[model samples]
Target: MASVARQARSAPAPALLSIGQVLAKLSPEFPDLTPSKLRFLEERKLVAPARTASGYRKFSSADMERLRFVLTMQRDHYLPLKVIRGYLEEMDAGRTPELPGGAVAAASMLSAERKLTRDELIREAGASPMLLGDAISSSLIVASDVFGEDSLAVLKSLVELQRSGIEPRHLRGFRAAAERELGLIESALMPVARRKDASSRARAAEMAREIAGQLEIVRSSLIRSALSRLDS
Candidate 1:
């Protein structure tokens, strides 16, 4: 079986894009995208762009699509890079792996995310405008003209919580808890983050994701334990 790199290299040929070209194509959609982020994605094995004799990176069309998928998952779903890498590995092996959140199929990698308008977001989430406004006010969701799937998911959860008589205001502490976790991640990442190289920055990003994944596991376990106690 070919390695992931070999598989990427063996894809149907198209005009390969330089890193700058890749940035040009992707930057409009991902304003925070930088060469370092691209390198970080590559380091995480999420993408395997071809290299020139001078060791410069060149992305094939498939590579570009793969990078887009990885970035989308990270930005929209807040998925860790390792999780994204595993999904891609399965896809490279010709297996249709389920997306982590089951939001969409792996095949959706080739397409752009469906940006939802404010009204559309509320409609899809089966949430009322008041509920959405409350979520924004609670700092659980940001106010924006156009929302992404994440916002829709949050609003949907808010609607369900309302059924349980839980309001967004009741979850305000979640934002502060998230900040605390971020502070922990930043502290853990300081060693790598201090380095001003692309490689180190990439490593720091990957480390942050791994730390966040661990924290999520701990949080979920605590919730389950508390729920079990309540049942008992």
Candidate 2:
């Protein structure tokens, strides 16, 4: 019976990964992850690994890929877990998932081939003309012949703020704060970004975006905590 059980566990299944193996494979990519975190991800239904006869969880190659995708979305996108799960589901179904823009989206918008005129940006962002002008003057939005989706998103946020008695002028400090953060990130990446390979350069860029996303998460959490205190 022991031999039968052993055989059952070892039967030519598609390559199964032990917990240690999984950690070894993924740790470099997600330095902060631990066994508990992997389990937590499983609890959240972000990953479902196969179970061996001995009841040990065995991750398949597909499971590893799914995990990579999930971690990438969270670290790089600063997306809520639920949103990342939805995107993963779409991808699993062979669909091209549209990722959220966060700050990287803002940067991309500035480089888009087509730009929106000031009126067009305001119309798309649902913002007022004065608010757009304020954003421009504050350096939040550059005066460009065209605007990208990032500009539109920023404009939309500005419109929302306006309803809450916050205006573009109130956010003037944001640009200065962002510049400081960017300096820190650039300094941290100096080693990797200095590499000559295209792949390394691309990876450094992704890492920069991921770091920015994490920072955004921290900032948002801090703001929410402060707001809660006010309510109390």
Candidate 3:
């Protein structure tokens, strides 16, 4: 199968854009984007811009679209570079693969997810006001006037867990556990986060998310193993 790099070159190409132009077009939506970050992304092979005879980078409109898709995944899903690259590779090879972080959209290129009001959140999550209050008090979820899609998902899951007699208050330790994991991630990222560039900060953010994803997998696996023991 042809690699994404080769396939990216297979199209009826648009006028090539310079790095500054790419930054200009993208920076409004992604304020922290920088030349160094673009270079970092290219280094990760998440994007493969064409090169000039003198090695100047040239980006096509297709490349821009791909970059937009990639940035969207990273920003919304917090997916790792490797995962994003794999997803791109799968698409390039004509396969419809599941997105990492449980994203169902085949392409979120045009996705601008909504933020819901408190009442809207409760209605959409199928949760009661009291349950949401309890969840907030127990630190299982944050108390926000406006909530994101992820907040709704968490609230809905809490509702299901409540049916199993696991109230939000019973999971108070979860917040502490999450904080402990966060501390570890922050410590590990200190080396990168200490850097004085926006690119380094962006890189650190992605790395933190990648580590968090791995931690979540381990946590879920351990829970499954414990449940299996109960069944046995």
If candidate 2 were superposed on the true structure by all CA atoms, what would the RMSD be? 12.2
lDDT tens digits, residues 40-130, model 2?
Answer: 6787689999897989999999999888766766664455566667766887799986765455633543442346887888887887788
Scored against the true structure, residue 173 in model 1 reaches a CA lDDT of 100
Quote the positional error of residue 190 for candidate 3 in Å: 2.1
lDDT of 1 by residue, 1-232 (tens): 4698899998886798998999999999988789988887776688899889999999998998788888877766567888988988998999999886464534345466678998899889999999999999999998998987668778988999999999999999999999999999999999989999877877777788778888989999999999999999
- Backbone collision tally, model 3: 0
The lDDT of model 3 is 0.86
What TM-score do all the candidates reach, one by one? 0.81, 0.53, 0.81
Order by lDDT, highest first: 3, 1, 2
Ranking by TM-score: 3, 1, 2
Cα displacement (Å) at residue 4, model 2: 47
**Best of the two (1, 2) by lDDT:** 1
Report lDDT (Cα) of residue 192, candidate 2: 91
lDDT of 3 by residue, 1-232 (tens): 5797788888665699999999999998788788988998898888899999999999998899888888878777767778889988999999988766564444344456678998998998899999999999998777888887778888999989989999998899999998999999999999998998778887897899789878978999999999999999
